[model samples]
Target chain A: MRLTTLQKFLWAAVAVALVAVGAVFLLVDRSPEPIAQAAFRPTFSLPDAGGRLRTPADFEGKHLLVFFGFTNCPDICPTTLAEVAQVMDDLGDQAGKVQPLFISIDPERDREMGLAEYTEAFHPSILGLAGDAAQTRAAADSFRIYYEREANLEALDVYAMSHSPGLYLISPEGDWLGQFTYGTPASEIVADLQARL
Target chain B: MKRIFATLALIAAAGPALACETVTVGPLEVSQAWSRASIGTARPGVVYLTIRNSGTADDALMSITTPAADMPMLHQTVMTDGVASMPHAMEVPVPAEGQVALEPGGYHAMLMELTQVLEEGETFPVTLTFRDAGKVTIPVTIQNIGASEPTCPSPDE
Candidate 1:
């Protein structure tokens, strides 16, 4: 059946409205500053694997990829470190300008368990950092990351830690850039970093 | 009969891909049991699987025992406002004629004080005790450290 002129005009208007909605979604997807802008400038002076004190100032001219997790974490921690390894591998030579750090929230246990070996298993480029309880709390507070150690009632001497699940990106100038939520694919993270780099 | 035996032998020999075979226990079917490679030997391990109950009565998973870890128990990863916490679950209910999936980011079997490091492409056995179904042992495949899903091979060979 042939459409009337009025019906045709309505269809055209609907098409335009759909296109407008699509454009809005695209705009929202491109800008990730809603949470990043709200975050404060992150600062921390933690000890690295080699027992040397390192801070954001130490990496004067490189982006920082920081993640906070404990060595004892089974599921999420290793998955994230693997993704960080993928990010570093995909970065190629540009990896030289990026520093990936695995900061231990369970400093006491992680220090004894050897956080260096844990991070090294994922990627050699990633550095493992562990500090005392007070230092770890300060670092987590600076980044607005929350972590709590809960005792496992079923098993004595065993515990689990609950923490914020995400990877933080900091600027070369030590500014809080943004974060990639848990399970964000390595390719998407690479694209975001590529644009910034 | 010969073909069936050959297939079973092939599955046992081909460890990783053929792991997580569906096994029936009473009125419940368990399948897709898998875990990820552990980072450190001292770090705990985890196992995920699915349970489909086909009976008229609901069944619950009571406990799990594995030689790979000294302490094996059921736990759920509860995410509240972006923070993730794991609380021990005494029993995981499997509703009658319904399914329960113990997967990543949800209910799973936690292996505390791992006796052996879980390496990628390796398989370990764990015996799950159900309230009504009694107990059944199943092999759990260890996938890549970042694997989020079980890697089960197709049966059409």
Candidate 2:
């Protein structure tokens, strides 16, 4: 049947509306939903103090508490690590479910021996991890940790490193929980972990 | 007069027994001197204390010397964007009628190239030279590796 020009225009308009509705539905179904911030996870494969490669899969079924610092840090690092030790003490038997990892950003100075001594001084269960320059950078980048070595003055052999201080909490299922800022009380950390666990 | 003399003797004895070791030189009073136990001789260690000046004039901490260490330098830990860096400080100022605290995350004395290891529970001597108060020697108690402050004896005792 021959259609009038107006009738043809109306049919074309109807077809265009149907196509628009179909495109909207396809777009909505194909696009991925936004993920919650807590569920974000960045993986890292780094070396432990014994020069053994460790990955996230190795820590499955346990919550991981990760911190970034150096051994020679006389003040902040030791203070924070002591707080973690206190948290462990506060956790009592439940401490077995939590794994505390100390990641060294200063690979040049902090080696197996130094890391071992430092971590052992704080707690026997706390594991010390360090990687080569490339691996260290990759891990820091993935964890969004900031670190920089200050200028060596007076030609002294010893130098200082500045880094972001915090405790990164990873869930048992390998998801990012949150970060506790510097000087977070041990009681608060223990309570948070208990609630989450 | 006899009672006053007896009271004075008791005060003197009590002063020395206080847990907070303090040395008064001229108008400067230094107290709570402490350092962490070192693992080895070559490793650097830190010393912390509080200095108060009661005199009418300001004083400056010129230098620190300890026989246990080869060289002692004044240093401060500065934190920027979560990074902590220790920079050598020429001198720390102590205002008159004010106090200055050398804490863990702040100013401290960096003992380099120790001649002997500082063992826990042991004490060492550190000589602080002030611009106006001259030099005062104080015993610094060696604390555990992670101790933030020196253990103070309770006042009740």
Candidate 3:
């Protein structure tokens, strides 16, 4: 015996739903993998913790992860470095091809040894760079970071400075790849970099 | 035996009970109200406050709410390649035992879109929304931006 019209309609609805779901998955498969925020590299000849000049030319053909911060930052600075350390680890052997750089915002306080000690705390692979205020400021401006000295004059060393919190990814050609925000998953970073590579 | 039992009961009744957090209006206890200042000439700003749980239960500070800005978010000021970025954060955990502190260079309730620049020693209403304690509206003191420590360092640098 033939089924009721209601029953036939239900079967047809099920067929349509299955096709729609399949087409969605097919479309999703065609899209590019989730790429990390593009990372930007700044030009600087500032000395590293060892007082050696590290310029853009040194990064000839390697992926670069750079962040601007000072030794005295208490929280976000440390946490973001820790996460970047994880990202380097996740890269495994390919990690050898990537360099993570820490630039000093407080160039006066973060001299050669100071920056070296700070970046080394996270990983031996991480390097700290520092330069005069004008140089650091240029790099910050290129990245669109907004930082200004706080208004109080009495506490010269205790003033507040606000800046962006992203680890920029730079290409071998030194073009800016997008950066990921703080606390990005290690797997996500590695996967994104791999696609870029 | 009756006298002994009565004495024992009295001792039990006299024992101190467990302490809970107490929420107070107006004045908030600040943690690490530092007298030290930054190395630059900019304003010396420190996030200060202590959380008191005056109840029998515990609560976590899920977020902070302030009308002073277009949006107030939890933020972590991180550094990379020498760049500092204060990224937005969703919540700051407040343990049952006490309140969490939002300190400088660590986690801070980032105030954005200020209706007016925060003036020193002025009080403004800031509401803290807790996971368990609901929302509490309190006045936050805008102290000297240039002061070095908790109270304020010397007027002279």
Candidate 4:
């Protein structure tokens, strides 16, 4: 195994050249964006409306489509879920690659059965989730969601909440990718998912 | 647009040319009254907008006026017993320095008992009545539903 000084220098030169070439490739990497590469995926292990713990890990290896809205939300929530179902239908075989999840910010009202019923109301694939105030707040904070209950001082029974309506796309690695708007056509979502897949 | 705003300011400052009191409300500034154009022989349509208070005083919106509708009340959409439902409302208020968003789903001016139809791309007039600001009219523009959910006016804005 003994080597001359010339042989040692030659080996050292070859190693250095390899390292230089690797660095150049790294610098010039213009590859497609990695799927859902969030530094820290804003995820939650919250309870379903039925009060059972639900975690984002349950939907790993698939795109987790998430939204923060209340069941009582008249305009946005229902319409958004409908659009999500439409997107799921559009995916066809690729649809299996993405799982739709509906997380309710109003855990107080979104009971487990209620959440299940709501999710089932749109499509069998959608999983409706809800949690107590703490868990709900944590989930929203993770996703940078803003929601508040609008209490009427005079009409206490008649109150509403304001919330964000963007659907998040989580990769199999749990990174948060950009989302589709509530009204984005289902065909567009399928196209984006297909490109990523 | 500049002329309209200028005329409104002059009327507000002068305090005499205006038929209604040129007063400030919560987050909503009152300029003039306006509503959507009702297509003749068509059914009534919904109208919505933001009511911002121009002063520090808190205010409550009392009513919305439209001649095209038989009744224009506050309406909200709710999920009850797993069913999607839209219900009527009596009032939506404007908090001090805060605003009343008349967006779809949560709080909206219901165009009930339509005397005429309101087609898309048509502008109309709506008189927003405030306890403090009196009656101010604003134009109602209709866009696709669910467009407001993602882009509600921000709090700092």
Per-model TM-score, in order, reads: 0.78, 0.79, 0.49, 0.49
Ranking by lDDT: 1, 2, 4, 3
The per-prediction i-RMS, to one decimal, reads 15.4, 21.2, 17.6, 23.1
Q: Cα deviation in Å at residue B26, candidate 2?
A: 2.1
Task: Show where candidate 4 strays beyond 4 Å.
Answer: A1-38, A152-155, B1-157
Model 4 chain B weakest 10-residue run by lDDT: B143-152
**lDDT tens per residue, model 2, A99-126:** 9999888865788337888788767889
Chain A only TM-scores, each candidate in turn: 0.79, 0.78, 0.73, 0.75
**Per-prediction count of colliding residue pairs?**
0, 3, 57, 31
Ranking by DockQ: 1, 2, 3, 4
Give the runs in model 2 whose Cα sits over 4 Å from its true position.
Answer: A1-36, A152-155, B1-19, B153-157
Two-chain DockQ for model 3: 0.09
Best by DockQ: 1
Model 3 alpha-carbon drift over 4 Å, by segment: A1-41, A153-156, B1-157
What does candidate 4's lDDT look like per residue over A62-145, in tens digits?
A: 888887776544355656876787677667788888888888877765673266766775667888778778988999878755
The worst-scoring run of ten residues by lDDT in candidate 3 chain B lies at B35-44
Docking class of 3: incorrect
Tens digits of lDDT, candidate 4, B37-125: 23232222455565667568888787777766655656655432222234444456778876666654456665645676554333456
If both were scored by DockQ, which would come out higher, candidate 1 or candidate 4?
1
